[model samples]
Target: MNTKQLIEEAVSLPLEERAIVVDSLLRSLNQPESEIDKQWANEAKRRLSELRSGHIEAIPGNDVFSKVWDRFEK
Candidate 1:
C-alpha cells in the first residue's frame, strides 16, 4: 500500500496499538548506540558504589530543584 493508505490504516488502530506503532516508528528513526548505553551504565554503577561507600552524599531532589529555580529567578 501507498503512504496515504498506510497512514489511514494506522489511524484506525486502537489507542494502545497506535502508541505501540508510534514507538516502533520512532525507535526505527533513532536507533540506540550500544557504546553510549554502556558508558551510562558504568557511570550509574560508579555513582551508586560511591554513595554506598559514604564517599558521596545524596541530595534531596526537591532541594536541588528549589536551588535551581532560585538561581534561575535571579
Candidate 2:
C-alpha cells in the first residue's frame, strides 16, 4: 500500500522480474515532451518528406547491412 511496502514487494521479485519492474518505473518517470523526442520527431518528418518528394531514395536494408558488415569485418 505504502511506498516502503511496495518497494519491499518489488525487491522480493526474481532478478529478471525485478529488472523489468525497475525499467518500467524508470520509464514512467520520463516526460512526454522530452527535448530529444521533439528533435527526433522533427528529423523523422524531414526524412519522410524528402523520400516522398523524390529528393532522396531509400536503400535496401540488405544492401545497407551487407556494406556495414563488410566494413566491420575489415
* Cα lDDT of model 1 by residue, 1-74, tens digit: 99999999999999999999999999899998999999999999999999999999999999999999999999
Compared with the true structure, all predictions reach lDDT values of 0.99, 0.95
In candidate 1, the residue pairs with backbone N, CA or C atoms under 3 Å apart (3 or more residues apart, or in different chains) clash, namely none
Which sections of candidate 2 miss by over 4 Å? 1-26, 29-33
Model 1 segments more than 4 A misplaced:
1-29
- Judge candidate 1 at residue 44 and give its lDDT: 100
Best model per TM-score: 1
**Maximum-lDDT candidate:** 1
lDDT tens readout by residue for model 2, 1-74? 99999999999999999999988888889746778898999999999999999999999999999999999999
Q: Residue 67, candidate 2: how far off, in angstroms? A: 0.2
Per model, state how many residue pairs clash: 0, 0
Q: What is the TM-score of each predicted model, taking all chains together?
A: 0.62, 0.58
Compared with the true structure, the alpha-carbon lDDT of candidate 1 equals 0.99
For candidate 1, the C-alpha RMSD (Å) to the true structure equals 3.7
Task: Give candidate 2's TM-score.
Answer: 0.58
Find the 10 residues in a row with the least total lDDT in model 2: 25-34
lDDT of 2: 0.95
